[model samples]
Target: MIIGVPKEIKDNEARVGVTPAGVRALTEAGHKVLVETHAGELSGFTDDDYQNAGAEIVGDRGYVWGKSETVVKVKEPIEPEYAYFREGLVLFTYLHLAPIPDLTNKLLEAKVTGIAYETVRDRQGTLPLLTPMSEVAGRMSVQVGAAYLEKEHGGRGILLGGVPGVPPAHVTIIGGGIVGTNAAKIALGFGAKVTLVDLNLNRLRELDDLYQGRLYTLASNSYNLANATREADLVIGAVLIPGATAPKLVTRTMVSQMKKGSVIVDVAIDQGGCVETAKPTSHSNPSYVVDGVVHYCVTNMPGAVPHTSTLALTNSTFPYLMRIANLGAREALKKDPGLAEGLNTYQGKVTYRGVAESQQREWTPAADLIS
Candidate 1:
């Protein structure tokens, strides 16, 4: 199989799909890998690195897209790359299609076999591909929130870990999943008072046991969220619903009532955000004031640290890539139920139930479509 790795073109996305080590793996396994020129540069990898790893360096994304049997990417394809889509070619990437109708339609129209990383699930019901980036985003959420809390950044002008004589800041996280858990860990480490909310009592119990009262785990409810928000200096929106849009836990009215100058790090912005007012922002302008609450909604936060992100993401993604390559996507999906869950689209059909249901399209079971 011929695989193409194109330089990510999404706003603030610097992580490339393939690394030199990954290229060597694919090539050693008898697959031909073509990396577009400078694809790895932003991730601190030189073109010579890929060349030494037995990858052919291609100049244009067009050639990579046109010739490769499979095209791998970090982010969703932007508008300019829309026409490069072709039938029979496999597209493996983080296709956040629930929020992007145009991209979904384009993928369907192109008839490419789209396998989305976000939709991929393991037997334990964990997002294997999305976990590493979630860890990165989760940790960064608090870091960014603390920075935004400074007076210079139009925040509450309070330090995350206040001086011994002063009271520490309060952080409220919506959700108790990977992102929220990591955020709470960081906030607690900073000596801030923290609360994480989730509907699952068992999950909350587990968190409580793990943290041992270092932070508070509350049963996620409207009143609890509102109360927490009223006292919070930083609110991190870390909710998720797999391939679907995140539930809007914080409404515009809720934002209006939040403590003045409090900072919000909406890590769920990639899934259209759990905060009602969050519009996708870029690294250049990562935050905006919404009803006195400062919102940090950069969809590509991991991109700001490309070298680390690229390595972290590729490490999680490479094993699956190897599986799909060793046994074609069709067979791999058929044999492994976890990989089968990744089948967002096969050929021209919308196979993922959540995406099809969200968009109100005809849903085809991946089992039926892949064959």
Candidate 2:
């Protein structure tokens, strides 16, 4: 099998699909790896490093795309790369298709076998491929929010951890999942008043044990969410429902009612955002003000730390990549049920229920394609 690693072209995206170590592993398994020139430059890996690990360097993305059976990428294909998609091409990447109708239509029209890293689930129902990047985004949400909270950034002009005789800032985080939990930990470390909301009682109980009364946990609802937002200096929208658009937890009305200059870091922006006001922004211009509330909605938040993100993402995705490379997509999906869930689109049909429903298109069963 021949695999192509193209340099990510998403706005402010610097991560690549594979690293030198990953190339070496694929090459050792009798698979050919072709990396586009300068694909690893942003991630601190050189073309020489990839060559040392047994990968051929191609200067043209079109040439690499045409020659390789599978195209491995860090982000979704942007407008320029859409033409590279051809019939029977295997696209392996983070295809958040439910939110983006145009991209989904393009992939289906191209008839590529798209394996989305976001929906690849393990036996325990955990997203192995999405976890590493989510962890990175979750931790960075607080770091970015804190920076934007200064007076000059049009924020609340309060320190996260207040000095003596001053009260700390209030931080409200939605969805007590991986993203929210990490945000809570960081917020607590800063001595900020932290509140985490979730629908699951058991998960909330576990968080209670983990925090040991250091933070507040609430059942998420419209009333609680709105009330929390009014007093919060910083809000982190960390909710997620895999393969579906993010639930609009914060409405336009809610945004209008929040305190002036409050910051909202929507970690769920990739899935269309929990905040209704969110529109994807680039790292270059990461925040926008609407209704007196600041929204941080960078679609590729982890891309800002390409070195760590590329390595971490590849660590989770490389094993699955090898499986498909060794056996081909049909055989590999037929063998592994976990990997089959990753196939959102195959042979010009939509197999993922969430995406098909979102687009009002006909759905294809995964079993029919893999079986």
Candidate 3:
């Protein structure tokens, strides 16, 4: 099998699909790896590193896309790269297709076999591939939120961890998953008052144990969510619904009633955001004032810290990549039920129920095709 790693072209997205160490693994397994020139440069992996790992460095993205049987990526393919899509090509990446109708249609039209890293499940039903980046994004959400809370950044002029005479800022996180947990960890580390809400009572109890009662864990309901957001100095929208679009937990009206100059870091922005006002912002311009509240909705927050993100993401994703490469996607999917869940599209049909229902498209079960 020939695998291609293209440099991520999304705005400020510096993570590559595979590191040199990953390439070495594939190469050692008798697979040929082609890396786009400098694809891993921003991630601290040099082209020479790839060469030493037995990967051939291609000069351009087009060559890498055209030559490889399987094309791996950090982010979904943007519009310009859409033209490179070919029939029977295997695309393995974080394809958040539920919110991107165009990308979904393009993959179907091109008959590409699309595998989404975000949808891949582990034996325990956890999203293993998406977990690392989610952790990074979740942790970064607080860091960015605290920065944007300063008066210079048009925030409420409150410090996350206040001085001796002042009260600390209040942070409300809207989920109890990986993102919410990490956000709370960082927010509490800054001495900010933290409130985490989730629908699962057991999960909330687990979080209580994790935090040792340091943060408030509320049952997720309309009233609790609204009241929390209304009183929050910084609201982190961390809700997720797997491959589906994130549920909009914070309404525009709720946002408008929040404290003036408050900040919202919507970590769920990649899945179309849990805040009604969030529109994807780029790293070049990461935030905007919405109804007197600042919104940090950068779709690729992990991309800003490519070195850590690339390593963390590749570490979790490499085993699956090795499986698919060594056994071929078809056999690999048939052999592993969890990996089969990653199949968003196979041939011209949508194979993942979440993406299909979210997009209002018909889907074929992965089992049917794999069998």
Task: Tell me the spans in candidate 1 whose CA falls farther than 4 Å from its real position.
Answer: none
lDDT of 2 by residue, 221-257 (tens): 9999999988899999999988888999999989999
Q: What is the C-alpha lDDT of each candidate?
A: 0.91, 0.92, 0.94
What lDDT, from 0 to 1, does candidate 1 have? Answer: 0.91
**Per-residue lDDT tens digits of candidate 1, residues 1-371?**
89999988888788999899999999999999999999999899999999999999999889999999889999989999998998888989999888888888988888888899988888888899999999999999999999999999999899999998999999999999889999999999999999998999999999999999787888988898888887899999999999888889988877888889999999999989998989899998888998888999999999999999999999989998999889988888888888888888777889998888778889899988666
In the range 1-371, model 3's lDDT, one tens digit per residue, is 99999988999999999999899889999999999998999999999999999999999889999999999999999999999999989999999999999999999999999999999999999999999999999999999999999999999999999989899999999998999999999999999999999999999999899889998999988898889999999999999898999889899989999999999999998889999999999999998998999999999999999999999999999999999899998989999999999999888999998899998999799999889
Quote model 2's TM-score. 0.98
Model 3 alpha-carbon drift over 4 Å, by segment: none
Alpha-carbon runs more than 4 Å astray in model 2:
none
Error of 1 at 92 (Å): 0.6
Candidate numbers sorted by lDDT from highest down: 3, 2, 1
- lDDT value, residue 262 of candidate 3: 96
Displacement of residue 364 (Cα, Å) in model 1 is 0.6
